[model samples]
Target: MNDEIGRRLREAAEAHQPDRDRMLARVHRGMAGTAVPRRSSGIARSWPKVVLAGSAAAGILAVAGLAVAGSVQTTPAHPDSETTLTVPSPSETPATHSPGTTGGTPPPAPGHPNRTTTARPPAGTPTPAAPAGRRVSEGPLSAQGAIDPHSTVYWAQATLTLDVAEPLTAFTVEVRVTQNGGVQSTGQWQTGPAGDFTVTAQESDGAVVYRWELKPGRTVPAARHTFAVQYNHTAGARNADADGYRVQATASDGIHTVQGGFTPAG
Candidate 1:
């Protein structure tokens, strides 16, 4: 054969000999553990010492921008609980100027109250004289001052116990009272301008005579009618304000009947 196949390929290229020193001693021990080559002392490799260290960090940021524009109005470092300005003194200014301070309209404080009425007046009218002498207590029906529970304007308060004689003649007196009897108070002549007779009906027996009866087609004024039977502050006045009211009488007139009244008012 061809020289024994060229002598076994030259003994396999003389038994592979190519370790290149052992791969150059393992790349010089891996470039001898890196990091360690400073000493350029900056400027030497220079870009003008990095442009003079960036112009000294921009002149320390332009002197810290002129120390924050010279403290623009300093103030508030801490200290203020009351600079004082309270206010609230005018009512013509008189808190006594100052001393415990006070002048008026501040009284109710002793008992605590600024404005209170809640509401009242509907059920009041029945005390027929007992304050000491005006005697006239026939059977619980007495509170006769007539409107003015606090200034009821037109006025109203009627009570006639009977005893007339001081002045009674304005269409011959004719009073009435029968609302629950199902309406029956024929209107007539009483309210001012001198039309007289807002209410003056009599004759439960003593006969001051004429309680109410002017119905000749009724032109309207009243037996005592402002509104027939009116005495309503009914808590505050509304509708049927008033007319002939304030009649307190105690009868001795012409004769006989325990007498007990209160009209004009106290």
Candidate 2:
């Protein structure tokens, strides 16, 4: 009876004994069943789960290590900041117009023939009016002076005073200027009531100048001439020349006086 009991005890010990390789083989075989059993509470089934979990953790760590290795290998090869960059050529984004052309016009090639452009003159500009107005002569009436051959201008120097009965606020008077028997008179600016004003003045280039003014404006004119000469010598005039060109323009309550003339003086 003792011998039989010893043999039975040895068989039980061998049957229930745990071994490392055996546990590992069981776990590998357990995967073919493809799912590890969830252990309720004991180390009996937990060893297989432990083996599988260890292997799975090792696989994950290996894959992560490979990814880190690959990143470290590639990151340093390319530059982070480039020193130079290329720009697109002009042909890729051509201009819409030439230097001065409007965008609405056609964009012709550099040497291509383009349509001619024109500009129209501005509107409402007036031409000069013919020179004709009231003329008077108190002394040496109708005396004349010749223009420089370079500048075709004529002047009349005479002294006269007319009685103005109207005492005009503003009115037009006439002066008939005869040069080489060609009668021409420019417009005159009216002087103020009972005040002295200029009849005419010379221009910078030795041209005849016509003067006019309304009352309370100025003793001298302060406006541009709408009537310009055909050939302008718009300077070098004699407005206060006592011997050759002198004018005392006066307008009173009713009468007008113009005192000026060309005397026998070079």
Candidate 3:
């Protein structure tokens, strides 16, 4: 009976014994697991906030850089503070015209034949109406002065026609051109024989004078004759209103004198 009681007490004490090593192992494992998650969760939450802040700063920098680049593109290379720059577009650009081409025809190209070019005169200086075939008569001489039809803007020719009803023993013809802006004589000619006349050109009293006179003992038979004078002028249609011509002759009937002024030709 003593042995049985001792064996039962031993079995009960073994069953109630505490497992200290197993409990200590479980507690250490639980603490390690909880500590790792706390550190990992803290890093995860802060990483997103840092990324978001960095993205916002990058966007602001990009916008500022674009604004600076735009400013550089619009500014002038050399700026003048007192002047304003106006850049004309292709559609609004102005056309260019040649100098000395106002109110007159442009000069012909090289090697081109001469032609009659007409245009309207400038404002405030109207072109005069041309007269008909009118003649000024003095005794037996009938004379007329006219501007040539082929006159150009830079040059002009004036013609004087004389009709003699009788034989002439002495004759003289003269043409006077006023100095209306750079007028200068170029040449003169007549329909009569060149050796039978004495021709001269001179400047006097603000005019260019061209004269043709019959040589000594030279006789002019009753006929019609034409005389012409050419000169250069300003680059525009010249006004012949101040130009004139005169003729004197000793005919069979009497000494006759005639004078006239130039009229624009058709």
TM-score of every candidate relative to the true structure: 0.20, 0.18, 0.52
Number of the predicted model whose TM-score against the real structure is largest? 3
TM-score of 2: 0.18
Instruction: Look at candidate 3 and tell me the lDDT of residue 137.
Output: 92
Q: lDDT for model 3, on a 0 to 1 scale? A: 0.69
For residues 1-266, write the lDDT of model 3, one tens digit per residue.
44444455445543453444664565555556765877657655665565566566655655555444444433335755686799998789864434344555433322212211222223453222222223489767898789989877777889898888887999988788888877877777777777778777666677777777798899877789888888777777678888888787998778887877998978
For model 2, how does the per-residue alpha-carbon lDDT over 1-266 read when each residue is reduced to its tens digit? 44444455445443443355876777556655634345323345577677777667656655555444444433234567767877889998885433333224221212212211212213442222223332334221222322223322222232222333223344322222222222223222222322443233222122233433334554323221121111221123322232222122333433333333332213
Quote the positional error of residue 126 for candidate 1 in Å.
20
Candidate 2 C-alpha error for residue 231, in Å:
19
Task: List the candidate 1 regions with Cα displacement exceeding 4 Å.
Answer: 1-79, 82-149, 152-163, 166-232, 235-266
Best-first order by TM-score: 3, 1, 2
Where does model 3 exceed 4 Å of error? 1-135
Q: Name the candidate that leads on lDDT.
A: 3
